[model samples]
Target: MIARAASALLVASWLVVGPTPAAQAAPATATCTSSVGPGIPPPAGLAAGVPGFHAQWYGQSGYPTLCPGERSTATVAYYNSGSRGWVNGRMGEVAYLGTWGPEPGQDQVTPLGGDGTNGSPATGWPRYNRIAIQPAPYVGPSQVAWFQFTIQAPVQAGSYRLYLRPLVEGATWLEDFGVFWLVTVLNADGTPPSPPAPPVLGTGYGFQNVATARGTFGVHLVKERLADVTVKTLTANTTECLNNCPAKPLAQYAAETNAYAGMNGTYLCPPDYAACAGKVNSYDYAVYNSTLRRWLNYNALNGQNGLLAFNGTTTSVYRRSFVYFQQQTPVTAAITNYPLLLQNGAVISSEAEQSASQLAKGTKGAIGVDGTYVYLVIATNANVTDLAYVMQALGARDGLNLDGGGTAAMWIGGSYKVGPGRLLPNAIVLTKP
Candidate 1:
């Protein structure tokens, strides 16, 4: 037997789209071919021969309009009405909001929400709060799960993304497939925010390195520079753009062209100075291609291969994305530029860079910085190489790992990329306008 229900309002809207052939209201309940909902058994048949299925809703607590805090939760139940084989699968995704576009401090990002470990746990069952995947109690397969640390609400709001999937378990406790959920939540002020005016899509391909003091940030599109990247503003003069000037800065470069090095020329900085110093450099999260090389796992941390970075409601670095910045004026602030990588303080220099040791460990993931925003990437497959590739493809100059394995998820650009997490987390959001 199959059952279904429309959220009432959605049904009403569907009726208004156009006159139905019969004009009769659509059925409120439809026969579900497979198990789908909060803690329920898989139907007679599904993609695989797993059983158990279910779904639920979660709401965030009091959060301000300019800056929001949010939370999410769901329940799962399994029964012995199906197959005798134990189930191993992943969960679905929940919708959330974020911003994107071209504006000063304007965030043009693909954000990943914030969720983390619930509490302390030494062994056996996975710790609470962090993202993970495990057998659904009495179900047919494993489901993705997550536990939010805080409620997150954004200042500007708009449709966002969410994705979820179920995976088949392997010999070593790893999953193979799962669902992807996409959802969008409203802003605190009631309505969603508008996307920023579109940027003049540039045709010529080139790199830009923008710098600024303090909290100021901006992106410059360069052309004909040797290093492939040059610093310039998209709108204002260099003088006025004391920090992020778009126009005049071009002329200033011309007058003092001799003072600056050739575009292709490399500039040297103290070796100890972090990864992004002295040069307008960037990191690319190249996709993982296992055909040629083998990915190494973390051998020192008791078989744990990677770390996590949380960005839910409570933490100061919550819900951010990666990008570059230049100040409007010269200012002094404690700034440390490096690839936003994270680790549990374990050194893995022989295999990777020392930065790898900085990844968030024990519980969740890590966070990376670009200008004023934060770029976050969570993992579903604990493969660190896979995580690095995804980040690079997403345009991260210096990437870091957020919670992964079962704890990876992202809610941005009106979409969601959830992997095996049971609970959802807040996100580093981006506004449109």
Candidate 2:
């Protein structure tokens, strides 16, 4: 968890085009037949013997944070609810697994076809060794055919999804019901992308991306040099921001602050708790701006650790704060948020579970500073530890994680590079010069 335990401190903090045939649902015990007709249909009474296979993926098993071309093992359990038995290399009856993907992130990407990012062409199929067996044949229904496959990830630096399905090679895909695991493949090359240059917008802020052997980073730079930063906030207030709606859109925050660019702010009293989120929620949220009034979370105590940095937009020694500003300088715009990610070039402890993406990865929103430039990062696919590493490599001497999943969002140049699914309660806005 990049969220550090603060004694008292600021806390803060895609799809591919596919045949729109309905993605069907089948229980582990349900006998499912292929909706997509098979090249070879079962004959006579043999039709009843055709296998009904289903799969479930447990990503934490062997899926690692891999780079393009890196080989990793994936564990999958198959369930059979048919009268036939699965045999390895048994011609048409062998039930094996195969994977291929344009990956999910591609749907969100603006493909530069000439640069190998063509969306129409089927790509991202790893050179997989044929496994013509199901480890063991099943004699009855409701049996699990568990097996593992070692395959390589695509050679790219972005989010990806490996679509896995059970198949009989030449027969047909185990369509309708299958799993696609999201992956974050960092660049094999150690090159950070050049700063973003808007086509026509005069917003001085730079919206760019960097890729490396680590992963990809979508960076929103406030300035070229160590420009001073003034953090802005939008708490619940009836007169401002569309009645200070439970969650304001990211663009709304940018417009109100006249921000050149910005991303969603600290996590709020989620709307799912609508009974408590609207006007009468009292969940001791903490902040140390001294300029704002917030419910106290025991004035920032132990065990509550998640912190980013103050004086972010400057070239200075990285200092972390918990109960007090470690630098002794008064924190002008600080929030009581936590698990500080980086401090003076060292990575703060981060746990895998902090990011609750079932596959160990998902959308991420973060704030970081390399002591010279403050950066706002939004990742459509990645875990917390991976995100922290990407920020650290970007020269972030001090960094912190922010709310992610559905609440993560980013807007620049009057457009959302990555829009949110719902409104946001607060945001970290960048006032452009």
Candidate 3:
């Protein structure tokens, strides 16, 4: 009788009203489970032969699996080898790409890893499954595979789950699988996205409405904009404004407010790097500083604004014009006592070694500060209201419109906030004192 009733409900749910609510609802009690078995081990001592890699299932333990538009209920973790041997000189780094469903197609993903880097190893090898003429030779005696994906609540208002397994020699390698780590994605930020609508601001060259100044506003910090400026040298005791224009000369420096001629003033760039700077489209970038233990960016609130927090210090917090950002790993690592950087967004020539288009047009992703909290946004078919809400809910006290239309991105700042090392034209910087 219960089975018949369930079948009737299923049929009525499918035919009579909208979609099936039960089908869309997340599983109330789900657990992630897995087992492991030994396989042909690595030959011996070579770093490549180390047993750091293992097969594991994510979310097999009890947790809510997530998808876009679904509230984050669980956080899952995967681990690499215990030591550094798992990482190669520059070739053996982790790479990831997202998808709508567990199918073999690059529908939403880009041809390359968003940028030209291709995220290929030293010998043009991908860390996970590869699609080419033939499988790239795995010279090492052993090989490990990793898979990652996330689900957001607003993207789809339905309960969803994903199953991950390894593929070997065109076959499913389920027996050798083992369980590794698992974490939970939670609603740390109580806010949710508002439905979509037209953008609050317009698409113009100059910005007229600066962030509200009525309240105690923090210093106006712009990500690095490549612009020209007048240079002046001041004496130790002379705390006066001094300006030396390229052609004309003056002894007084312009005040921060005066820098803008007036509302709709012509966009300006700093006199540092000669790349296009000033008033980029809606977007912002933040870099995680391990030493300072905070997210760092150009602080426009300070009086003297030259690389405000460059060279291992966060004291310089002023000298911003607009904002820009690049995507990077969630944590920071050290090579020469300096953080390891990479490209994860848009590709522009002036961006230096950074990939100019790491997070460019129409792409959607999430960002979090402390590992326990996170916020995800959907670019495609998402309204500005919803976007604003999600960001705020995720602890973005003050956030800006990152380049969207696929260029949107976020990195989990569990350890170090990944940084794309170029100045964006416009960015929304956070101001939490």
Highest lDDT scorer: 2
Question: Where is model 1 poorest over a 10-residue stretch in terms of lDDT?
Answer: 261-270
- TM-score against native, each model: 0.22, 0.49, 0.20
lDDT of 3 at 133: 12
Q: Looking at candidate 1, what is the lDDT of residue 77?
A: 17
lDDT of 1 by residue, 297-370 (tens): 11111222221222221112111122111111121111111233332222122224323322211112333333
TM-score of 2: 0.49
Tell me the spans in candidate 2 whose CA falls farther than 4 Å from its real position: 1-119, 122-229, 237-245, 273-284, 288-303, 309-322, 325-329, 352-359
Off by over 4 Å in 1: 1-382, 389-394, 413-415, 424-427, 431-433
For residue 114, what is the lDDT in candidate 2?
13
- Can you write out model 2's per-residue Cα lDDT over 101-133, one digit (the tens) per residue? 223231232211111233421222222323224
Ranking by lDDT: 2, 1, 3
Total clashing residue pairs per candidate? 133, 36, 80
Q: Which one wins by TM-score: 2 or 3?
A: 2
